[model samples]
Target: MRVAFVSMTTTRHRDTEGNRRLERLAHQLADRGHDVTVFCAAWWDDYRDKRTIEGVTYHGVTVSPAPTSFAARLPVLLARYRPDVIHVRPRPPRAVFAASSGGTLARAPLVLEWYGDEELADSRTVRLLLREATAVVTPSEMVRTQVRERDVADERSHEIPDGIDFSLIEDTEPGEEIEVAFAHPLDEAANLDSLLLALAELRGRDWSVTVVGDGPLRPDYERQAADLRIDDRITFAGECSQQERIAIYRGAHTFVQTAYREYFARELLRALAAGCVGIVEYQAESSAHELIENHRRSFRVTDPQELADAIVESGDLERRTIDEDFARFDHRQILEAYLDLYRDVQESHGVL
Candidate 1:
């Protein structure tokens, strides 16, 4: 199967969660011997129109992420590429319109990956995109529900979650054993205040924590931790690589998710796969709770007080170096789901 990925910028240019997910999907699909090509704005230094890196080819649609110019040129390029399915996102909005036109020209099914993080400044345009797309993929039911509110049919909207590497979790040696763990980029949306306050609730308990990731708000979070008087027991390890994080998750007994906004609780997934009892705080805008709703060793809370109680309670759960329960979320399994969706859509469209 040939896939034409339409995005104005990739991880190479934007390095966002959504872009990184697309990059992984493209490369993984290519690894399986499928012809995958990314139609994106040029990020390379050279003036070449296209380049192939890691088996997947990238066709530069524009020199930069110029929405107008990128939109104007996308339809013809996609029409020429003639992929079996056209996968895109709703970021630029105009680019989606261009992709729709190109899909119409190529008679290919248009699949939109709605991360639910992008702002919907124009509802009419979003509705049009939702109505026109052959299939709309979201990272979780929280996002799928939002997409369905725009009048998209149930069959047209699908929930495809973030993929995990179960093998990595199994192979990584445990890092410094800690009682509690939390991971997220320390930003305004991180909502680390909740975790800190929760830790404060466990003030007298014999416990320690490791906070991973860093950002502009690191200093603020550090100060908040100090003010809570739990800084002594906390280690703000700063940014750590995936291997480092997996090791920590493996050593820790529990992992908490308190981010104000999460399309998908990726770090929590890693922690859970590494056998950390998941503790998630419920937020209207976050889908973190979704990952833990079905797990026996998990709890969902709405505030720091509840979070603290859950953390203390999780000690009763058995420690595990790995939990095979999450094997379904492996990258290969998720890739197969994508292939299944593509084949199902292609069959409906008579493309295969």
Candidate 2:
């Protein structure tokens, strides 16, 4: 299968979770003997042309950095790639226009893989774009419900969970010290204030808290830690490469996810793979709930007291090992699901 990935930007964009996910998908598909090509915006630096990464080809279409929109450029790109199937990742509001434009140009199947509702456009445009999509892929059932309620095509919508690279799980040295880690860009939705308060309550305990990732809210979070008098026990390790982040995951005994809102709690998956006991907030309609509901060894708490309680109860180190339960979201398994979906779509269209 010749698959063309159409996204606003590639992995060059920092703090971009969706771009990294697309890169993983492209690499997985390519490794399985499929011809995968990425159609994306050229980087702002010296690279004004095309390139390749880990066997997947990238067609870098030049667009004005100031005034250009991805929607305006996608039509030209689809004509250039002419792939058997078009996979569109999350984008700005222009994504709806781009999907429609690509659909008209390719005459091939289009799949909208949405991470969250953050990038969605108006209702009319969303319905129009989804109506043209051969399949709509979302990371969780929570997102599927959102699309359905928004009147997107339920018949074409599918749940495809974001994958984790299992390679990062091997040869990891689980640290001897007891430390709880929370890795995410500090944002309002992350609700770090609550986590900080909980951590403050456990200050004198034998546990240390490490906060990873950087964002606009870092200073505020830092101030909160100072006010709580737990600044020394809390380590703010800024943004890191994938390798570094995985190593941090490996070293931690407990992983905390305090997100007030989430599409899918991917970092929690990485924590599970690295053998950390996870503490997450339980919202029935949130992505975190969709993944860890009824799962043993995973803690879901609603309030600050519950989060603190879960963290305290998870001090038993013997039960935190990564077992068969955490093996379900590996990259290979996720890739296989995608391959199955592609084959199913092809067979249904009588193109197989």
In candidate 1, list every pair of residues with a backbone clash.
none
Scored by lDDT, model 1 comes in at: 0.91
List model 1 lDDT by residue over 1-352, tens digit each. 9999998988877777888888899999999999999999998899899999999999999998999999999999889989999999788888889998998999899899998877778999899877768999999999999999999899999999999988888889999889989999999899999989988988989999999999999999999888888899999999999999999999999998999899988999999999999999889999998888789999989898999899989999998778899999999999999999999898888877
Candidate number achieving the greatest lDDT relative to the actual structure? 1
List the lowest-lDDT window of 10 residues for candidate 1. 11-20
- Whole-model lDDT per candidate: 0.91, 0.75
Instruction: List, residue by residue over 208-282, the lDDT tens digit for candidate 2.
Output: 888889999999999989998889888898997776777777888888887777787888888878878878877
Best by TM-score: 1
| Clashing residue pairs found in predicted model 2 | none
